[model samples]
Every structure is written in C-alpha cells, then in structure tokens.
Target chain A: AQRVTQPEKLLSVFKGAPVELKCNYSYSGSPELFWYVQYSRQRLQLLLRHISRESIKGFTADLNKGETSFHLKKPFAQEEDSAMYYCALSADRGSTLGRLYFGRGTQLTVWP
Target chain B: DARVTQTPRDKVTEMGQEVTMRCQPILGHNTVFWYRQTMMQGLELLAYFRNRAPLDDSGMPKDRFSAEMPDATLATLKIQPSEPRDSAVYFCASGTGTGTNNEQFFGPGTRLTVL
Candidate 1:
C-alpha cells in the first residue's frame, strides 16, 4: 500500500541547534514529495518540493530515491521555525489528478 | 493575491442534520480538493475536482457525503444525517496546474463539531 510515515510525533530543540524532521514513504511508481508547514492558528502552506531543489526559510530537503526518503533539514533552527511539519507524497500514475498523502506530522518546538 | 476561500470558520450542529460547506477556488485554478484534518489522522483527501467536473470521490462516504462543483467558482460539500464521527476540520485547496508539483493554496479550514 502507498503510505507516508513520520516516526516522531514531536521534536524539541533549542535555538541555533540543527534540526531534522524525518519522512519516509512507500509508493509503487515515481514519487513527487513535498514539505508543508503550519504555524500556530495559520492555514497550511507549502514549504518546499523535491523537484524545486530550492530552500525555503533556511530549510532544505533532499530526495533520496534509493532510500525512499525526503527528510527536511536546517542547520540552525530559529524560534520562528517552530511549527507543525507534514511530509506528503503524490503518486506517479497519470490517470488521476495529483492527490496528496500526508504523514501524521511532526511538531517542532524551538525553545530559547 | 490568489487564495482559496472557505466559509463559516467554525460550525456546531446536531447529528442527523444536514451540513453544507462551501469553497471558492482561486481564479484560473483548474483543480480543487476537499480534505479532512484531525489531530490523529492529520490530512485526508475526501474528494477532488478539475475543470468543474468530478475526478475522484472514492475517499468520501457515498451515502452521506456528497461533493460537487455546481459552477466553476463554487464548490460544495454536503453531508446528510451527519454523524459524530464526521466532526473534523474540513479544508479546501486549489492549484493552477495538473501535475504533482503544482503548489496548492489552502484556505482557513472550517472546524465542524457534532453534538
């Protein structure tokens, strides 16, 4: 079955510390991956996508097809970066319009 | 600026009552999606439409849940005899393109509570 998994429910980090949110997915065909973030009381927004190869808000994710992973990382976490992050995958099949399958999510708490 | 718009930021209703949620997709966005969010399940896609036509609705409950785009600008999700289990934050999102890489813009979800 196609699935997305985020092993940790919550992660805590101090200001200026390196942060990593793990994401793994299982799909039959080529996978299109994305990272979305939601700030407190805000709507969900796109953070980055594997194809873009662009970093957003000092965050970058690398798609490792061999490992079937697209983990988000930032060298120095900021207090403002604390938010709920979700990893999503869209299947490769062309028959259907893109449908996002999201992991439960990881809540990153950055403390001073 | 382009953004999806959803109505009734919050709703409280009794079971077995009809519930309607509406969404207005950004102009030029051909695809619209309905999703349900909960603390436990995160986000689950309930239905998707493109070009004012139904593409897929397999994720929704056929008996009680119905999703439609009566016109290009308006999309609605209706639940008849809604149950307690149906209580959730429903989100509407839209994107301009067709592929998986198309970035979707989401509206502030409607939080539904069943009493």
Candidate 2:
C-alpha cells in the first residue's frame, strides 16, 4: 500500500528560528512528492514539488531516496509561515494528476 | 488568476437528506477532483474526472455517493441519504497533468454538517 506519513502533528518555533517538517512515504517505485499548505481561513495550495526543486516562501524540500523522506525545511521561520502542512504522494504512473494521497497534516506554529 | 470555485460554502441538513455540492473548475483545466477533509481523516480523495468523463470513483461510497460533470465547466457531487460520517469539508480541485508536475489548484471547500 502507498502511504504518506507526517510524523509530527504539531511543531513550534520562534521567529527567525530554523524549522523542519518531516515527511516519509512508503511506495514500491519512485513516487512524486509534494507539499501543500493551508493557512487559517485559506484554501489548500501547492507549496512545492520534488521535481521542481524550487523554494517557495523560503521553504525547500529535498527528497531523500535513501531514507524514503521528503522533509520540508526553512532557514528562517516567520510568523506568517504558521499553517497546516500536508505531505502528499502520487504514483509515477499516469494516475498522479487528480488522485493524490495525502498524509495527516502537521500544524506548524511560528511565534513572534 | 484562474482558480477552482465551489458553491454553498456551508451546508447543514438532517440525516437521510440529499446534499448537493457544485464546483467550477478552472477554464481550461481538464482534470477535476473531489476531496473530503476532516480533523480525523485529514484528506481523502472521493472522485475525479478527466475530459468531463468519470475516471475513478472507487474511493466514494457506491450506494449514496455520486459525482458528475454535467458540462465542461460544472462538476457536482451528490449524496443521497447522507450520514453523519459524511459531514466534512468537501474540496474541489482542478489541474492539467500533461506537464511536469501534477500540482492541483484547490477551491475554498464546502463545509457540510449533518444533524
């Protein structure tokens, strides 16, 4: 079975502190990984994908095949960065588009 | 900016009532999806459509849950004889997946409550 796991349900850090949200997955083959964020009163939005390798809102995630992890990290946390973050995975096959499997989200709180 | 849109931002009904939620995917988006989000379950995919055709609805309950794309721009999910377990936020997302990433754009979800 394919599954995405966000080990931490809540993570807190002070402003300007470094933060990491851990995510791990279980899949047989190479699966596409993505991070989605949902802020208070806002809709869920895509943060970044493993393939893009682009940093969004100063956050970047590196897929570690050896560890089966795709942890999201930020050098400096900001108060505005507080939100519910979800790690998602989709099989590399053509079924990845609208059928993403999401992990139980982690709530990040960046306090000032 | 292009975005997916859903109607009836909140709905409250009695048990065994029929509930209908509507969505309008981005203009050119070919793939539309319906997802349910709850504090307990987090997020679960209910159904999806490609090119206005139903692709997979295996995630949805067969007896009471149904999804349809009546036209190019409109997609609807209906539940007959809804149960309390069905009370959750239903999200509509759309995207084009032929490209590199299968990033989906989500709409403000519909919050459903059953009494």
Looking at model 2, residue A59 earns an lDDT score of 98
Q: Ten residues in a row with the worst lDDT in model 2 chain A?
A: A90-99
Candidate 2 lDDT over residue span A1-112, tens digit each: 7899998999999999999999999988678899999999689999999989999999999999989999999999999999999998876665554467789999999999
- Candidate 1, residue A82: lDDT: 91
- All models: lDDT? 0.90, 0.91
- Which candidate achieves the best lDDT against the true structure? 2
Say which docking band candidate 1 falls in: medium
The 10-residue segment of model 1 chain A with minimum total lDDT is A90-99
Estimate TM-scores for all models.
0.94, 0.93
Q: State the lDDT at B97 in candidate 2.
A: 77
